[model samples]
Target chain A: MSFEWPWQYNFPPFFTLQPNVDTRQKQLAAWCSLALSYCRHHKLYTLDVLEAQESPVFNNKKIERKLSMEAIQVVFEELRKKGNLEWLDKNKSRCLVMWRRPEEWGKLIYQWISKNGMVNSVFTLYELINGDDTEGEEFHGLEEWMLLRSLQALQTEGKAEVFSMDDGKGVKFF
Target chain B: MDRFSWSSGLLEINETLVIQQRGVRLYDGDDKAKLDVGAALLSTHRLIWRDVKNHECCLAMPLSQIIYFEEQAAGIGKSAKIIIYLHPTPANKEPGPYQHSKYSYIKLSFKEHGQIEFYRRLTEEMTQKRWESTPVSQPIPTGSATQTGKTRAVGIVGIERKIEERRKETDKNISEAFEDLSKLMVKAKEMVELSRSIANKIKDKQGDITEDETIRFKSYLLSMGIANPVTRETHGSGTHYHLQLAKQLGDMLQAPLEERGGMMALTEVYCLVNRARGMELLSPEDLLNACKMFESLKLPVRMRVFDSGVMVVQLQSHSEEEMIASALDSVTDKGSLTAEEFAKLLGLSVLLSKERLLLAEKMGHLCRDDSVEGLRFYPNLFE
Candidate 1:
């Protein structure tokens, strides 16, 4: 499926940090929302600042305006402040994007599991994520870290449990 | 006052202007008769006192009517005067400013240090009695002035009545000055001063002229009018014209600068200066060129160009350090501020506030936090 871009992606000044306090504030907000929605549309689970700058989300080839690396970091920092992002390392070279929180993902996975009559059923992490039976699901291709976090949320709520077996990581739905 | 008759400032056919003293005031006996700092001209035929701003409020009497005159030495808070005792009003007296009075004498108070010269000339003219020898030449043409023979008198009345009478007089003089362009040019200085005095009187009585700020600001601009703007035709062109223009601009900017928080945009100064000059509009190039001489000419106000290329006219009294210090204070008080917020706090424009904030930042008294949330300034904790 093709990813949809926000209208601000075409604006040239959006790449540059506005000098005016009020204007810059609005620009930052737009950047934050655009960054989040773009990640959500592409199902991007992680982002590198430099790599993101090269992406269509940060660089508009038609307008020839590229969001500076520093500006990208600023947008990421704003997202982190809002709890939608987390730096992968102390150096902030890469970041994990969470357009949907772990708890929200857990709710979706649980709803799917319950609809599929999978209660009390055991399944490997790969089967749960890449399994054919879970195909056509919203979290069908969820990343490992994101899947693990969602499973942990369900485990905390006593709805599901995960175990490391000789074969591989597996989950048992309650 | 009754001994004086309404007269045009024009000289009689055979008469000539002998001496002229500006800043001379007339006294109705001892009371200030609202003669109000006029230009007193001693002609070959008569002594004429005309309001310096209102050319219409002129009074004259034949020098022959002076019984005698003597110099009254200046006292504290009082100008030196020449008290002239006049012969009683003749039964066929020409219509004058007042109908009756108890005092038979009037005083010419010289406020501009010309009492001695005027007194000497008066004595010489009185001894010579030049008009008697010439008989009575035909009265000079009164031009388009309306016949002002309406008998007006100072009545013993309340303060309200006095204010009403003054307003009437002001209205008449203003109308007369507007009779024609040349006539207005001749009387512009008189009108400016007259308005200034009236404004002062209103301010004194009411604490302010009006609740409307635009009206007050307009009146203020009008009151500082350049009565005689240096024109290329009169002062000639080149450096001298610009110098005179610069000087005139300096004189005209003092009050406005004080009122506008010691700084103004060059455009605003141009607007205000042209407004004060009335029809004599100044070109932007000329204004810029004239302002360039402000520093060398040692004017109180100067031209300043911001780093962003905006030109401002500021009073020399407002220093950069003071401006930076004020910006720092506002930032510290507010904890943090944007240019718009700072502008609101200081009653300044966003451009000026931004410049001030940048200045403070340059001084290390403030720090800028520029983010997607927009830029804000905070007092520099490290400094």
Candidate 2:
């Protein structure tokens, strides 16, 4: 019989620390991982520690654990320390998630175009995604920011050209 | 010579006195001094004694010397008393009683005039623990010398027998206390009471105790050690060992942090350490000092301060691999693995693993995909 996993005992604050030094260190690491995982799973681009409820770290029920302001700061601090995340607002309510680093994204785009025999072909932004260009490929759901960064990188390397007209439309070519 | 005096209080030529509670000093034409008055020490007023170059010299007189001044018509600087004595010589060692056994220096005392309530209180405290004066030794009786020698020999034998008895008692007590300690945790109250009674015996017989005896007693009592060790109330030069006690308390909490992958909060550590110490609740200052001492030692673990001024203590070598391995092992039993699926896993919640995964992606250990669902990492296509 498939075991019923139950309601997944979602004590939210377990993801958060107890404002204690040692507990908080453990909590921060745990929360940062949870947050990263959540972001990666849902393809979330930005996270607001304030508004996010499904973020497991914000809920605490099993052992009545809770995250103090300091605990939240520590988790964010951990992310910032690793250079994988950034605060988006002055109040630090939101943070930009860098799922893959900018440089690696550049390298991926370079490799993808060369391998696909699209080096000498021109393609529209929509065609790159919804068109046949990236059908059945990993780049199908690539974020606009990642695509833009990859395109800019290719342009820098003289591997591609980007053109814009009076109507404010854009296209790319190898 | 009586250095300076205003009231009935006497001032010395080269001695420093803190106005525990003030009074006056009177000086005669022959450079004699006396004082009588009242001054409060808690006020903003401070009388710093100094040498000619204005260092910490004993020659500076107490502010009570101002008690010798007459009621002068208000002059600002002149109204205050500033008496300079000859530069005093430094002691062969730091000043303590019995430093100069031979020639006595001028001694100063204050006699209060008005509202000497504070002075009276001070005197009461000083006199509470009065010294018993024993007369200077006369001669030992010569007739009993031979008998006394025999008695002394017998007395030594008796003391040795007593010491043996005490040793067995201490050893038995220690072994019992530790017996309970070895068997998980027992009733803390019982342990404390056991220790307390033993401490009482140690205190009562301290006069007859030798160093070896005391050391043995302490070793046994270590099992029932201080329910409350040195506190701020009982801290002084003699209690540096209290730091070691506090450090041991910190050590007990190590297992809890270690279990959670070498990460813990500073405040939690403080609470756990203090709780383990039982009655030894350390002040915030003591806790901070302990943390700092640990930092200076450059232990394998470290204290961290976040951007939000939140402090935490974590391992310096905290490895993401350990966390990831634990997380992966917990989940690897299931066949399929996806980025979002892994993110939802508790094993992935550890900070080090998240960092490692990011690094692995950067170093070609993994690759990531940004889908409408979210961002996900998988085994690197590059690798």
Candidate 3:
């Protein structure tokens, strides 16, 4: 629940986006790294800009400096360009933080399924995400869209089958 | 006469000979008693009578004070005489009590038949119109004249002889030269020559003075006079005057620009050009226009306006690459470059230095660090 911020987070100019081109580029890069690291430490998959405005990650209370919404959007845009973030809506009020790429997540899921001997068994998306049997797993309580994308990646590799039932989406591995 | 020569040795600056008649025999009034035989030179400003036997005993009279000039017909026994009546300058107007009466008339007999008529017409032309409207005053006596009678006067006769002798020497020539108001054209040339000689003397004594003092003295001499001023009357049209003035300004800026490392702020250039110009000062707009004219003329100097709106005049040979290299060297040596520090390195004003630093930053030659200590520049390591 606690995240140790980089030393630059306390630097005042770090919160204020630099106006110079080169300085701004470096500042954006720093912001992107800080955002990703902070999100990963808290296991935060969704970042709401309005909510982040009040969070310690975006607002450095010791320095009395906070990134403007526009500055935050610019940093997020850079992250999105690097395939590290996905805008959830047209307004970009929220973004899906890809702490790990879907391909990497798909490989992790395959390892988990093989270790549990569930290679020939079927499981509901709900069980795979929030089931008691999958407790303490990295994919536990993962967002459905991200989980489905990871499963689709696995299906593309011919390692799993995805099906729909009245209960919800299901995945079968062979 | 046919053998007469109006030599430069006899004429002073601004003294143009309007008429010269040789074999002219001057007499005392109409008595036909010949006083002295001399060659007469009529100038726009004065009449010079150089004694045929002794040129040192030459006499000069201002044409403005000439009361009358007449050509008398030849009597059976005498040749025609050209009579000139002169009103001696008033005692108060005269600087001292020298020889020559307060008012006198002299008659000159010429051997040439039409010479008297020619002298009459030339005298009319010289005296009819005043060369200058200002009334002529007697020339001030120099130190030599005043020293002669004052320091050693045993008796009135001795004093009179000394004054006469001094009058025959330098004072007479100088006073005559000064008495003519139109002689300013000649005086200006003399003044330039005199200053040049003084400047040379100062240059000889340069070792005695400090470098700063020497520079100050040289600048004083340089700004003392403008020999050929560009005026509307001299150049004829406004455009020509501006063009000529621009050329003059360009030439004048060369030394100062070199001193300042091939660049100077426009305001500084404006001040320098105006100071050198003295009376004929150009407006800032005129200076800017003149600078703009430099571009088309392919002059060696140029005017540049920085992004921050500061303008400067820099030489065409000035290289931004060289400036950047120097700036980088300074930054490396000093670690960081403030406006003040960069100003010293570039020999420019702080404001201008800051502008230059910003320009370098824009050009990717340097980077800026804006912080609590104010803006400082470093070499663009990012590039």
Candidate 4:
């Protein structure tokens, strides 16, 4: 996308951390919005700090700009402070985006299965991902481990039941 | 020849001509006082013959003008005279009143009356440029590079090799000077680009910026202009002169200083001035001294030391009291102001935020609000 004022993108001060607290706060806010937009649009759940290829926030093509590690940390720290994200690993290299958290994802799955009347039906873990029953749900490309965990959470809440068949991987839902 | 004698000896110069202004002082050997010539039209000083003609033309006297010579029998003015000959001789040599031992005597004492007349004629020709009247600065039209019998300058036979050597030396010096200047110029251009891009970025994100932030941004912005200022290293023996050159650099910072309400820190000036000077940098002491000297002389600018002991160079025309009064009036009419809001009302500079508030408070122009959310500022408590 072309900026109306392309010179704004090329300005090197954009890369520097403003020492003034008020300006830095504003800068941080803008950065947060940019990061959220990227994560949501790309359907990305985790961001690798070391990987420059995947993170869209660092990619400023028109100006050939890239945010510093400190800037990236500041933005993520701000997001974490706001309870909108979490570091999946302690070193903070990998961050799990919680703008839409696992609990919310689980809730979405529950709603979809109930609407499709598949809450009482049986299916294998493989079939649930590859199954016709979940035809138009957010569950289609959902990670298998995440889907199991979410399903298990639903079971614990008494919203559904799971029964194992001869195959340990197979399960019947009720 | 008589004209030369009259101009060199009888031309009484005034006092103002000999006094050094803006550059190095080349003093007269005999006169501890200013060499008195005559009053000059350009200034109040004595007009030396050389200075009167803008230093391009000068009169020369023959050695016979020496009415009485001090014989160096044992050691009396002889050593000092010897120094004149040991040093680099003047390229266009002239015989002054005194004869020094080191310089070649040129067989003057042996050649009597007739030789003196010949010497006078030679001096007159060299001084008047009798041969230089020819306008042909181009190649001799001998049709080819290897052609012979081309007319050359007089007395330049064995001196031809010396002329070539001198030409090469001069050419080398000129090219080296230009090369250094060009390098500095290119560096200056790069610095400008760098600073521009930085300032542009800061400008783009101006919305969330606070007054203190704007102040800092301004400082950064000021420094951006001086990407390639001349420094001391670039002009080694001319640091003082270069310092003066840097003051001219401060002229460009005027608009930014004015916008920031008429004062900026020396640290800020230093960064900006050094950057602008390119490779020609003045030391911090030199910069300060230059500023102090400028102030002492009642230049348009002055150095303002705040109550906090922070030094800033600013235009004397800027009035802090007026700014505070105006800021007070605006804030009081509104009844109150947050520090952030107040900064917006007045263009806050890089001076300490607390100090600004403290000053306003002291002036009965502002009051503090330490509330649950955060510390803030409001209109003066008197209202």
Candidate 5:
């Protein structure tokens, strides 16, 4: 699916960090929502500084304007302050982009499980991520780290129980 | 003129007329004197009257001949009159209008203006009684010298005399206008108008007044044209003064502010205000205080101090939003602009232009690009 661009994406000044406090606040808010939607559209769970700069979300060649490394960092910092993003390292070169939180992923999975009458069925992590039965679901392409976090969210709610099997980790839905 | 003796019978050889007033009519008893609508001259020795159109027909009476004098305040549409009570005519009288008169006093009515000031000076000359005392050491060569000069002056000599007389009057007018502030206060209303017209006439015609004095005089009189300025004596030294002053400032600055985009520096206000006040000098503190009252008094203008301590007086209608809009429009019209470039484009000072750009930025209508090249602003597309 193609991601629709915000009108500000083509506006040159939108690529630079505004100097005034009020203007900068509005600019950062616009940037935060744009980054989240772009990530959700492409199912991007993580980002790195170099790769992020190369992303269409930050670089717009049509207008020949791109966010500087420092300005991009400022926008990410704003997103982190709002609790939508997390740094993966001390240097802030890499980050986790949680467009869909673990709780939301857990809710989607539980809805799918109860609808299919598989409330008490047990499933391996790989089956939930890549199984033929889950191929048509929103969580079908979930990464291992994201799958574990979703199951942990379900466990906190007492909707699922995770245990170690001989082959790998598995979750039994309540 | 005919009611009194010929003008020569009035003054001593060395004396000259001290002051002259125009459009005076003399009264003999209750009837108007036949010779009227003339100029009146005040000398230390006598009161002389000369027909304005016919300068040769002049009449004079010595100050010693007057017993006392008083002023008749003017009524509606009536000229101010000065009644001079005289002692009886001496046994030996010169030839003129009447052989004798029934009344002991004669009146001089100011048909146009300034009988009051003339009366005041007349009283002063009478009280001093200079004719009874020593002759003035620096004697003016008047009656006898002029008579001789007229006969001998020819060609270049005649032209020089004409220039000398015109220059003398022009010099006198300049001195009277620039004289002590206290003296100007007493006769300011009428005198300011009189001098401004005369000075302006002299200003336009360079060769009429002597070049040296005219050049020196023009500098001071360039802005000296106002009349009846509010003073401490007129509006007490209280808040009342500031109110009157603020009102006057509002009236005066309205036109100038409109011409200058509805804003001006406080220092410019001081110069413009003081120049319009003419002789009365205004101090900076008083000007600031008066300007401060503009808004409180609901005037059309108000004084403002900036964050960086710059002070300005601007029209009440001038608003921050308007300035920001204008700035944003200009920047967008040109893609982007720096403070200096905008200043040149809008004919505004760089500091004011910068402040306007900053205001636009603060309002989120524009954003700045500050770099090694310089600070420039572009329209805020992020909105």
Candidate 6:
């Protein structure tokens, strides 16, 4: 999918992290926004740091400028601080892109369940993620860890209960 | 050679009498009265009487005529006196019809007995010189002849003769010490004044000297080099000398900085200042330290290191915003600027120009475009 990049994306200096403190802050903010929107448009839930180095979002081939790993990590760190990203591993080699926050995703799932009249029904995690019935949904085939976290958020709100099933994990709406 | 070297307009020798004498009265046969209060200088050919009150009252006399030189003994309530006897007319010249029939003498009475010693030294110098050389004509006793012949010569011819005589007398008295080397020394002092006056004249004439002449004059002044260089010996120690060097560098940089539009690379300033200083050169480290001192002193010039690690000296008043605006003005129709083009416009080295462009990019005044042509800068249209 095509994404409209900001005018600054064409600017070579934008690819190089600015050394000045004030300029760096603005650069970080711009990078964070661009990365978030780029991931959202492509529906990419996880971004591999090493892979992003070669990706068009991090490297602008037209300008022949590429952001270093350190620069990418710094931009990701800013997104993490704003609750828009989470490191999947301790080394921060990969990150879970939270285009929508966990709480927002929990509310989305609740609205979907209520619309389909599935309140008080049980659904296995696998069926909820990849079942044919949920094929058209935004959360279908979502990462299991992110799905589990969203369900846990719903459980904290007393809207659902998660329990172990013989086949796999399952969640039941109250 | 004559007893005195006349190559110098006046007699070359100079000797000061040792005794401090004051308030001695000289009487010339009741017609001339003069005070001899200061030390007398004995030169090779003349006895020069210098007055303490007015140094211009320098009277010289030949050594041969002081025949009866004697110091009278002090008496009760009377000061000691020196008696100098001379021929009624100068012994070497024809006696004129109006010459005095009797002998003539000058008697000087001193206030202190110490002066008697000076008289003795004078007598000794006169006797020693008399034995060494033959007599020469005295140019008519100036005091006595002026008094006697004043009424006879009053016409234009006499006035011209007086001027000629005065010119000759002045030429004989005002010794030129180093006639050949003196012109340069005199010109050095006069050149500064002359340049200032010429500058004023140019100002009055309003562009009469032209830009080329002004530039030539500036180069000429720069070539003159520092007259009094501040070395370690001049300023005492290394640190103090460095501080003084820093000050001198700041002063020297003002002109070049103005010429370059308020900025110059550190290397260029180093070369120029060292050239101006001639023998005294500062090391690069010393120059850096000197620049650091400017911060504490609140000097108007400062040292700046760009992110690219290139250093330059610029005036504190120089604004990056203004530099960007000017650089933008020089951008080609393609809306890009290479370091070479920027350097040419800013009158800086390509390296320094690149550094400044990088700084401007950091400041968000411009954005970089790295292409096959090389790293170029364009105005930050994103802003």
**DockQ of each candidate, alpha-carbon based:** 0.01, 0.02, 0.03, 0.01, 0.27, 0.13
The estimated TM-scores of all candidates read 0.37, 0.30, 0.51, 0.32, 0.51, 0.51
Residue B78 of model 2 has an lDDT of 24
Tell me the tens digit of each residue's lDDT in model 5 across B1-383: 22377543235665667789999998896678988599889988778888988776877766677788888988998888998887766544444567678888898989988887898788888888776685645332222222222243435665577568669979998888778855757665565676788776885887877888886675455445454677888998878898898898888788778877877888888988776676677889888889989988999899988766778899889997898899999999999899999989977768777878977887789987654457778898766
Model 5 alpha-carbon miss at residue A157, Å: 2.5
For candidate 3, list the clashing residue pairs, or say none. Answer: B1-B22
Q: Please write out the lDDT profile of model 4 over residues A3-112, one tens digit for every residue.
A: 23222233333444444455456556766666665666565667788783334456556645567787778878998887667788889988876554556666786677
For residues A1-174, write the lDDT of model 1, one tens digit per residue.
Answer: 787776666545567665555556667888888888888898899998878989988888896777888888888898899888999999999999999888899999999989889899998899978989989998999998899999999999999998998877889999
Docking class of 6: incorrect
Model 3 residue B169 CA deviation (Å) reads 63
**At residue B211, what lDDT does model 4 achieve?**
71
Candidate 6 per-residue lDDT, tens place, A1-174, comes to 478999879777687666556667777888888998898788799988999999999989897888888889889999999999999899999988988888888898899999999999999999999999889888987888888899999999999999999987999987
True contacts kept of each: 0.00, 0.00, 0.00, 0.00, 0.52, 0.21
So what's the TM-score on candidate 3? 0.51
Q: For residues B1-383, could you state the per-residue lDDT of candidate 3 as single tens digits? A: 11111222354444456777777776655454323676776776566567677666555555655677777878887778777776644332222222434337766788655575567666666655544543235222221223323433334765577568767878778878877744754664566667678778877897888998878877876765554667667776566767877787777777788888788889998887765655555688878878877777777888888877888998888887776677677776786789998898777888777876776666666666555567777665543
Can you write out model 2's per-residue Cα lDDT over B85-200, one digit (the tens) per residue? Answer: 22232221112212222221232223333324433443433343211122113211121122333232224565576468569979999999889765644465566677779878
Residues B162-210, candidate 1, lDDT per residue (tens digit)? 4686699799988787688677666755766766666666666663445
Candidate 6's DockQ is 0.13
Clashing pairs in 6: none
2 against 5, candidate with superior TM-score:
5
CAPRI classification of candidate 4? incorrect
C-alpha lDDT of candidate 1 relative to the true structure: 0.80
Task: Place model 3 in a CAPRI quality band.
Answer: incorrect
What TM-score does chain B alone reach in each candidate, compared with the true chain B?
0.44, 0.28, 0.44, 0.37, 0.43, 0.43
Poorest lDDT segment (10 consecutive residues) of candidate 4 chain B: B78-87
Superior by DockQ: candidate 1 or candidate 5: 5
